[model samples]
Target: MVERKTIFSYLPHLILLIGIAVVAFPVYVAFVASTWDPATISNGQMPLRPGPHFLENYYQTIFVGTSRTTREPVGGMMFNSLVMALTIAIGKIAISIISAFAIVYFRFPFRMTAFWVIFVTLMLPVEVRIYPTYKIVSDLGLLDSYAGLTIPLIASATATLLFRQFFMTVPDELVEASKIDGAGPMQFFRDTLLPLSITSIAALFVIQFIYGWNQYLWPLLITTRDSMQTIVIGIKKMIVTQDALTEWQIAMATAVLAMLPPVLVVILMQRLFVKGLVETEK
Candidate 1:
């Protein structure tokens, strides 16, 4: 028998649509503003509809550098952000997966202690340890470098915990099967575990990538050169405190461009991401 539809059944969908509208309206305004001229935006005459300067504004934002605060083109900053994000995402996955594998499979001295230590670091985020971390990077002359941008932030306790929890759920029969098939630890990890963990890896990569891309404070502290800035910092720089001089159109364009990569990653990985979070059996 078919279920009957009711007004109450539609409530959740209506609420979700309202939430989407609330979130999407500002983004729509930003996109509209990006298509407008600086004068139109600064004078508060920008229409709700898309403007005519879309191509010009985006071309200037991507290629020709903004005038006031950041002279570096948005493209360069996007490149920097891309490098940082990819490095952080890959590095976190590799290190966290290896650590989790070892913790779950290997018998070593102080294994639980090591795991606890890593877990404890979740409390001490980058903000809390910024001063010393900055000093060390500065002393090592890694300032304004890709290494400086990514290395310090790559050791992820959250990812490690996630991988560890997933690994713990693996059946003992699989380990025995691997042993019977003459699979060494590395072989097992490479051939068996890696394939099994793909969805989780995809999910974590999306998260870490966004985390790295949107980094502001740490990049701000470490990087002085315009070439080393991320998209997030570039957007901040474009919007000057002086409203008249700020390139509102270019800034809006940069903001819109900055959102694209993360959105694409989420869209592409949507299936694996959802599975990684919810799936249990191998």
Candidate 2:
């Protein structure tokens, strides 16, 4: 007789299957909606079928045919999103690595207190601090600037803390051996520490990249000019316009477009990220 699976093993798979469906349903609906016409969407049509207008909608959304101020093309929007996300990711890595190295390897007075101050920012999310952050951005003459948008979120306390924790696992003998061979702090970090922490760094890179890519509310609040608008802002602008009704098809299309980068990044890096986690256990 065939053996039946136990509830314990089967239950987790059931939950995961449900979760996957829940997450994928919206994306599938959006794709289907993007292919349909605005009239069909407005008329409460169900099971939206792919129409011939799919290419037309995509073309109009992505490329410019007329005026510059009429709403950004999908290409420009995607480019802006790519640049911002990459900038944030690179900045986060540079800043966090230094911060992690300092906290993990160096000893100084009131160091714990300093780390805590940064950590506390995590508790009060960007939402809570928007008023003050906006003011600070304005006062610094950085409003609508890439520096203002990117710099505020450049350093992540969470990345530093996690890296520090992982770094603690590295053998002190390695540092001592390097020092005995006449390596300095910078050399040791670059030649020894970083090489050993690739997994942790890869893991952090994926996480931070996603976090930066998905940032919407902060970008919306900060960027005023159309030129400064990122993909998320462009998507929002397409959905609700002061002059006309919401264009549901284009909005969904824009969303689907915006999602590609992060999704592709994760898919490409999933192996490294997972391998990093596996190595972390050892």
Candidate 3:
């Protein structure tokens, strides 16, 4: 019976391991390809060992030659991406927390209907509004600028919804006690609610940060010039050469680079994320 119980406990873990590998195999292939020369990739040869050319591919993508002229470097494009992503992440978190707190804790008119309407926006993806959004950005003279890319996405339904749901799990009794002790709404939130909701906030942060970081269509549509482009956009361009034969190696290398920042953020926040969720249940 003990042995049978042990098998049952391990079954789910074994399945998850298989699932992770299935999802990760393509990423592994891309990383391996990035370490090889384009010539080897084009010839359909699989990488047997890591080659010295990976750094060469990375350096070429990030820097211009000695007699450089007429283009921004890949590293500069990546910096733009980082700035945009960080801006959106911070702004979205602030807005979502405020909106969620208001809806959950404060009394307001048409609040339920307004919240539902905003939640519906999640159904309509950016692709559906591409042309109209482009025209609006251009009309506002925000095209090819960071403002165009970051401002429109500062409000997100998913974040607000997640935060609201989490906030509801917070006890009204604790909030009432704070109020009795002379805590105003803002004071109540700052002193009690926000501290308790840290885990849910961390989880939401990871999800929203990844969403902003991986955003492609809206940024690409708004920014036409290479100088204003993000890392993902530049990587997309790098994949296709002058004659349109894809440079698979360099493209893979850029992809690997772009994926690293978010992965690191998630890994760092994972402990807080688990703890937060556990606290929410209490």
User: lDDT per model, in order?
Assistant: 0.88, 0.78, 0.78
- Cand. 1 TM to true fold: 0.92
lDDT score, candidate 2, position 37: 79
Better model by TM-score, 2 or 3? 2
Q: Write the per-residue lDDT of candidate 2 for residues 1-282, one digit (tens) a residue.
A: 366766666777899999999999899888888888778888787464666678977887788511223366778767777777888878987888888898888999988987898788778878888899889999999988888888998867777777778788899999999999999999999999889877777777776677777889888888888777787878767654452477777788888888987888778998866654454343
The lowest-lDDT stretch of 10 consecutive residues in candidate 2 is 64-73
Give candidate 3 misplaced runs (Cα > 4 Å): 1-22, 65-72, 241-245, 271-282
| Cα TM-score per model | 0.92, 0.85, 0.81
The best-first sequence of candidates by lDDT reads: 1, 2, 3
**Model 3 TM-score, all chains together:** 0.81
Candidate 1, 139: how far from true, in Å?
1.1
How much is the lDDT of residue 4 in candidate 1?
80
Report how far off residue 180 is in candidate 2 (Å): 1.6
Clashing pairs in 1: none
